[model samples]
Target: MFNLFGRSRKSNLRPPRAPGDTVRAKDLAYLQKWSASRAGVEGFVEPETIVNEMSVVFVDGTGEWTRRRIGGPKGIDAVFQGTGVPLYFAEETGYPQRMRDRIEKDRIVRERLKQRERRARLEQERER
Candidate 1:
C-alpha cells in the first residue's frame, strides 16, 4: 500500500540530521572548559529534536549554565568519563529549580538596566 508520495511510512520515521549537526572539536573544548572552571557542576542531556542535535547543559552551583551539542549519548559518556561530573537525563528529570531562579534573576536585572537607560534618555531630552 503506497502512500500519496509513494514512499514507505517507515522511511519517514526518523528525520535526517541538519548540516553541521554532528559534534565538533570546538563544542567539546567549550564544554570541557566551562565544566572544569565551574564548581558543583551537573550535566543534563537534552534529547535531539528535528531542530537541534542532542546536547548537554552544565549548570554550576550558582545556576550559571552552558549548553553544547554532544554528538550522541556515547559522546556524553566519553566527555564526562573521568571528569566526575554527574549526568542526568533532562527528559527524565526536569531542570533544577536553581537554574530557573537564576534565569528569572538575570531577566529582572536586564529589565532594570533598560529602565535606567530610558530614564537617562528622558533626562537628556529634558535638558535639551
Candidate 2:
C-alpha cells in the first residue's frame, strides 16, 4: 500500500468511472447534418467501423467533437439523419495526398512529443 516517498499509494490505476457511456443516435445525426452544411468539412471514413468503449469523434464547422459509443456504419448513418448531413466515404472522392500527409504528420508529431516528454520526465525524476 505504500507509494513513493513512503506515502500511501493513491491509485496508480485509472479512476473509478460511472457506468454506461451513452451515445444518443440523434446527437450523431445532428453533428453530421451540421458538417454537410459547412464548407471545408472533410469526412474520413475508415474501411471498417470504429469501435471502443468510449466515444465517436466527428468534425463540423465548430471543429472536432465526440459522442459516446455509437457502434457501426449503420449507427453513423443514423447520425446523418439526425444532423441532416451526408456521409461520404473517403475512397469515393480521391483525397488530396498532402492533406492526408498533413493529418498523419500532425498525429505522429503529437504522439512523438507525448512519448518524449514522458521519457524525459521519467529520466529527470530518476536522476533526482
Candidate 2 per-residue C-alpha lDDT over 1-128 given as tens digits, one digit per residue, 9 for 90 to 100: 98766755554343322233333646565555656666555444433322233233454444443333444455555544555444555456544455556668879999999999999999999999
Q: Which parts of model 1 have CA positions greater than 4 angstroms off?
A: 1-22
Instruction: Write down the RMSD of candidate 2 (Cα, Å).
Output: 12.0
Encode model 1's per-residue lDDT on 22-77: one tens digit a residue. Answer: 54667667877888898989989899776566888899999999887776666677
Q: Against the unseen true structure, what C-alpha lDDT does each candidate score?
A: 0.80, 0.52
Task: State, as a TM-score between 0 and 1, how close model 2 is to the true structure.
Answer: 0.37
Strongest candidate by lDDT = 1
lDDT at 68, model 1: 78
Relative to the true structure, candidate 1 reaches a TM of 0.80
TM-score of each: 0.80, 0.37
Q: Which ten contiguous residues of candidate 1 have the minimum total lDDT? A: 14-23
